[model samples]
Target: MVCVANTTGRAVRMPRPGGPGGRLLLAGHTGEDPAPEGPDGTVAIAPHSCSWWAI
Candidate 1:
């Protein structure tokens, strides 16, 4: 697998739980998944530390 070296910060917004006026925003590396979905989000293996949260 090929990985792009990125240092700039980025954010991805997705529909949050519930209905209107709800949204989920997460910041991290942007990559693709070549496998099926699991119980959690896409699995990512990074050389550095990472985290995920919901607000």
Candidate 2:
């Protein structure tokens, strides 16, 4: 599992989750899952918020 936090004010998008480049799951605080990855192969994160996914 992974948790990604966007500290900046602007929203962000990233590649779909998996593989070696991800942080391991935290002990708690799995934020809500965003909408599914877009066809362009990315997930959206709201500004100054967090999201999580299984690696």
Candidate 3:
């Protein structure tokens, strides 16, 4: 799990595999595209939580 801070500096849990998706969510709705994924393919975030994993 990756620990990230928001605009308010609140640390939140995120997935290392799907970091891009999480990063976008933390962007405060900035309409920015997420980071590129590695060769492993983009990760998917699970509902009810910010956690994610490779499918």
Q: Give RMSD to native, each candidate.
A: 11.3, 4.7, 9.4
TM-score per prediction, in order, is 0.20, 0.62, 0.22
Better of 2 and 3 by TM-score: 2
Task: Give the per-residue lDDT of model 1 (tens digit) for 1-55.
Answer: 1232223343222222232332223423533222222245443323332333332
Clashing pairs in 1: none
TM-score of 3: 0.22
C-alpha lDDT score of every prediction, in listed order:
0.30, 0.61, 0.35
Residue 13's lDDT within candidate 2 is 81
Between prediction 1 and prediction 3, the one with superior lDDT is: 3
The Cα RMSD of model 2 versus the native structure comes to 4.7
lDDT, candidate 3, at 37: 47
User: lDDT tens string, model 3, 1-55?
Assistant: 3422234333333344444443333322333333444455553232223322232
RMSD of 1: 11.3
Off by over 4 Å in 2: 19-33
| Global fold similarity of model 2 (TM-score) | 0.62
